[model samples]
Target: METIEKRKWSVNSVLLVLLFTLFGAFAVFPIVTLIIASFKPAQELMRFGLNLKIDPALFSFKNYAYLFTGESLYLTWYWNSLLISAVFTVLCLLLSSMVGYGLAVYQFRFRNLVFVLVLVMTMIPIEIIILPLYKLSITLNLINSMWGIILPFVVAPLPIFFFRQYASGLPRDFLDAARVDGCTELGTFFRIMMPLMAPAFSSMAILQALFSWNNFLWPLIVLRTNEQLTIPIGLATLLTPYGNNFDMLIAGAVLAILPILAVFLFFQKYFIEGMTAGGVKG
Candidate 1:
């Protein structure tokens, strides 16, 4: 019986490994193709298109050089994206966490109704309300500004819901203890509870950062100036009726993913920890 069980466990482990390997390949194939294509010149990319097989003669750093040293405004676009993403992520986490904490910890009337509203907001797709959002931005005179991109969705409902869930798991004893020790409500949150919620912060930080970094359509609508354009919009400009700069476009896309990779690598451990912690609490 023991030997049979051991054999069964070994087979299951092998199957799990195989499944993960397949999933990883599926997710990574496009990224790998893009990176390889970024090294090829526009003429080569146009003629050959993408392939798994690589040729040493076809690969060059000219596209990278053009991005950095050439007259192209790739660096400006990169800076714009990084700045917007960073600001949006920080503000989102701060505001959303506060709102979440209030909903979870406080016993104010209409709390459940407010949370239901947040849930409903999350269910609604942004595409449905984008026109109203654009009109609001125009009315507020926020168009063509970086704040225009950052403000509308900075305190997003998803993060609020996530934080509320995570905050629910926290011990009420800590709150009581802090109150007895003469800590103000804000002081307890910032000085004590906030430290204990590190996993939630890290998880939300990574997600909000990635969303802000990749946001395209809203920014494109709001920002009319080339100087204010984010990475995605800037890359889109590479393709026009007049011509296409495939090399630079691919290279820019490849580089654009680096910040997201960095954010995930930094917070990946906390991301799993936060999700599990919240899940177990409920």
Candidate 2:
């Protein structure tokens, strides 16, 4: 019976390894394809399209060279994206987390109603309210500016909801203890409670960063100048009616993935913990 159990355990272990290998391959395939395509010349890409196979003789750094040295404005787009995403992520985390912590810990009239409004806002798509957002941006003279894009999404509803759920799981004793130690209401939240919610902040930071990085439609509407365009919008302009810069486009996309990957790796330790801790309360 012991020998049979050992065999069963070995079989299960093998199956789990195989399953995870398959999933890893599935996730890595597209990224591998993109990297390979970046090396190939534009003519080759136009002719053969994207394929996994690499030919060392055919691949070169010409695309990347052109991206950096040429008058393509690629680096401008990269810088713009980095700046906007960084600022947006920091602001969203601060504003949303505070709103969430307030809803979670404090008692006030219309607290539940405000939370319900956040939930309803999450259910609504950006496509639905973009018209109003555009009008508001125009009214505030934020058109053709980074602030237009950043301000509209700074207090994202989803992050607020997530933070609120996560904060709910935090002990009220921490708040009381901080108050007893002479911390003011704002001081307790900023100095005491905020540190305890590191995992939640890390998770939301990654999320909000990705959203700002990949945001295309809103940036497209707001930013008109070439230098002001984010990476997504700038990369899109490469496919104009006059020319199709497949080489630069593909290489730029691969380069763009680096920052996002770095952010994830940096905050990875807290990601799963944050999700699970918050989810338990909800």
Candidate 3:
């Protein structure tokens, strides 16, 4: 009976691995196709769209060369995206985490009400408030500025909620210890709690960076100038009624993936831990 049970377990494990392998291939298929498509000429892309079947002989470095040497404003757009994402991620993490930590740790009047309001804010779609936000941006003279993009959604609801939940799981003993040691409130947070919350920080860093990097609608509405456009907006302009620059578009897209990919890889070790801990803790 034991031998039979072992055999059954082995079979199940093998089947599970095969299933996951199939799913992994499916997930990776599009990215593989995009990378392959980047190497081909714009004419070939316009003719074939995106596909894996292509003549290797036709592939060349011209697309990549054009990205660097050509007069296209690809580099400017890339710099804009990187700067916006970095600043936004840092500000979002610091502010949202503090707000969340306060909610989780402090005993104050109407605290529950405040948290409920945050929840409600998360439920409310950005589309509903975008008009007011746009008007406000114009009033503040933030239009066509990077700060216009960064300032509006810096304290995003979702990250606040996540950080609150994660902070709730932390032990109050650390807070007491820090206070007893004569650490200031801000010092306590920075010195004592922030390190303990490293996993949460890592997880949110990736998520917030990804959001800022890929954000489209808000930036589109706020930034009017060509030079101020993010990568998504810039790449989108390549396709127009007059002509299409599929060569630069595809190549630019491939390069665009690198920053986000690097961020994920950097924080990946803590991501799963933070997510699982946050999910269960609060």
Candidate 4:
């Protein structure tokens, strides 16, 4: 009987491993296809579209060479995306985490009401307010500028909600201990609380960076100049009524995935922990 139970347990573990391996392959398939597609020429891509029918003879570095050496604006767009994502991620984490920490830790009049409003704001779609936001951007002379994209959504509600939930689970004993040690309020947050909240910060850093990096509609509305366009918009311009630059487009896309991939890999260790703890704690 014991032997049978042990065999059953081993079978279950094997099944779970196989299930997850299948899922991982599914997730990785498109990326693998895209990478393969990047090496092929524009004519092959136009003829075949994206696939995994590997042709060693057709593969060459010409697309990448053109992407780098030609007068393509790929590098400029990449720089713009990297800069915007980095700045926006830092600012959003700082501002939103502070607001969330305050809401979670402090006692004040109408505190519940303020939290309720934040929850409500999260439910409201950005599309509803985008027109007003655009007009405001125009008024502030932020159009065609990176700050125009960064400033408007810096204090995003989702991060505020997430941080608040995570902060609620923290021990209040630290707050009192810091105060007894003569640490200023700001110092307490900067030194004591921030380190304890590392998991939360890591999780949000990836999320906010991904959002800012892929963000399209807002940047499209705000930015008018080709030189100032982000990666998505820039890549899109390669396809037009007059001509299509499939080689540059696919190669540029594969390159564009690196920064976000790096951000995810850097923070991935803490991401699952933060999400699970934050969800359960508050």
Candidate 5:
């Protein structure tokens, strides 16, 4: 019996090691390649091929420097992307939270039907509606403006689902207790629920912020002006007329992804909890 138990423990340990080993090779390798690529010069980068090369002498910071220089316009992209994503994320938080609260807390007519619709909307890709949406934005005179990007993002279904799931897990008695103290429905939501909901709220905001920040296609189709472009578009502009200038391109990619990486690293624990909130609930 003891021998059999030992064999089981050994098997589990080996499986665990293999799982991490596989994940690291796929996930860590690409990011490591990107970070290492940022330091290589143009000629050296070409010799290294697609994968990241490991060489002490081949490294240079020129890619990073060139990225920030006035000629690059990276800072303009940075600021514009930051502002647009921030505004869109804040709007999503407010809208998703309100909608989620209504669905999870209120006893309403057609509630399940409305929620099913929202769930269905989540499965639909944004690509299908882009053409008509673009035409509508053009007719509304919002083309090439930040609104071109921000307006459509206001109703993303996942954030609403995330907020609803987390809100559902909270104790309903607290909401009832607030009502007993003469709080209006609006008052209870803003005063009691909003404060308690901050952990999940921040997590969802981070997710939406990253999505909006990394959003490429919508801004690419709608934004035509150089000054109006977001970082993803701006970085994409770095692609040479001939071919990708791999060093500069990767540098811009690094810059584009770093802010959200920082945010995730800081708030990761709460993010995981929010994601798992709906797994086993009544």
Candidate 6:
């Protein structure tokens, strides 16, 4: 019996090790390769992938250094992305959380209809709206403006749906108890309910921030000036007809990805809680 138990334990340990090894090869290895490749000279980049063999002597920080030089636009792209993503995230959270909390807590006429409508809006294809949105932006004389890009994304329906779903998991008795203690409707929400929903906010913030930061297509339609371009668009601008500038392109890609990676890693715990709260059972 003891011998059988020991064999079961050994099997489980081996299985865990195999899972780790597989992910290390597929996920961790690619990131590690990219980090190493960023230091490699342009002469070695094409061959700097995960399985490639090369001398460590061929690696240098010149690629990163050149991209970070005073004349380079890398910092500008980073700054724009950070500012826009932060603003968009907060706005989306506030709007979605308010609407979601209202729907979750209140029973009003047309309440179910409104929730269904919001859910329906989430199903609308983003591509279908591109042309009409561009036309509307033109009519409103918002061409070449950051508002043209920011304003449209501000009405995020999916965030509303996600927040509403999360709100459903919260205890309704908390709101009733708050009211019994003389709390106003808005006060109960602001002080009690919103605080309880932090995990959901963190999850939505991570996702919305990533979307806003990496937003490419809408920016392409609305932003004409290089100065107003977001990170994704800015990175694409590096690919010009004059020459591709492989080293600079790779450098820019590395620079662009780091912040999003950092944000995800930072809020990973909250993301898990939010996903679990929303009933994924993760």
Name the candidate that leads on lDDT.
2
Q: RMSD per prediction, one decimal?
A: 3.1, 3.2, 3.1, 3.2, 3.5, 3.6
Give the alpha-carbon lDDT of every model.
Answer: 0.86, 0.88, 0.87, 0.88, 0.83, 0.79
User: Candidate 4, which ten residues in sequence have the lowest lDDT sum?
Assistant: 273-282
TM-score of 5: 0.87
Model 6 local distance difference test score: 0.79
Clashing pairs in 5: none
lDDT of 4 by residue, 10-97 (tens): 7878999899999998999999999999999889888888799889999888888887874888888988998999999999999999
Looking at candidate 3, what is the lDDT of residue 218? 93
* Clash list (residue pairs), candidate 1: none
Minimal lDDT window, size 10, model 3: 273-282
Candidate 3, which segments miss by more than 4 Å at Cα?
1-22, 273-281
Candidate 2 residue runs with Cα over 4 Å from true position: 1-26, 269-281
| Model 1: per-residue Cα lDDT over 133-172, one tens digit each | 9999999999999999999898788778888888989999
TM-score of every prediction relative to native: 0.89, 0.89, 0.89, 0.88, 0.87, 0.85
**Model 3, position 176: C-alpha lDDT score:** 96
Model 4 superposed RMSD (Cα): 3.2
Clashes of 1: 0
Consecutive 10-residue window with the lowest summed lDDT within model 1:
273-282
Cα lDDT of candidate 5 equals 0.83
lDDT of 6 by residue, 1-282 (tens): 867766555787899999999987887776666676777776676544444444677767798888778877777777777888888888878988999878877789999999889868877888999999999999998888767888887867777777787788899899889999999989999999999998788888877777788888988888887677777888788789986666777777887888778867888886665444444531
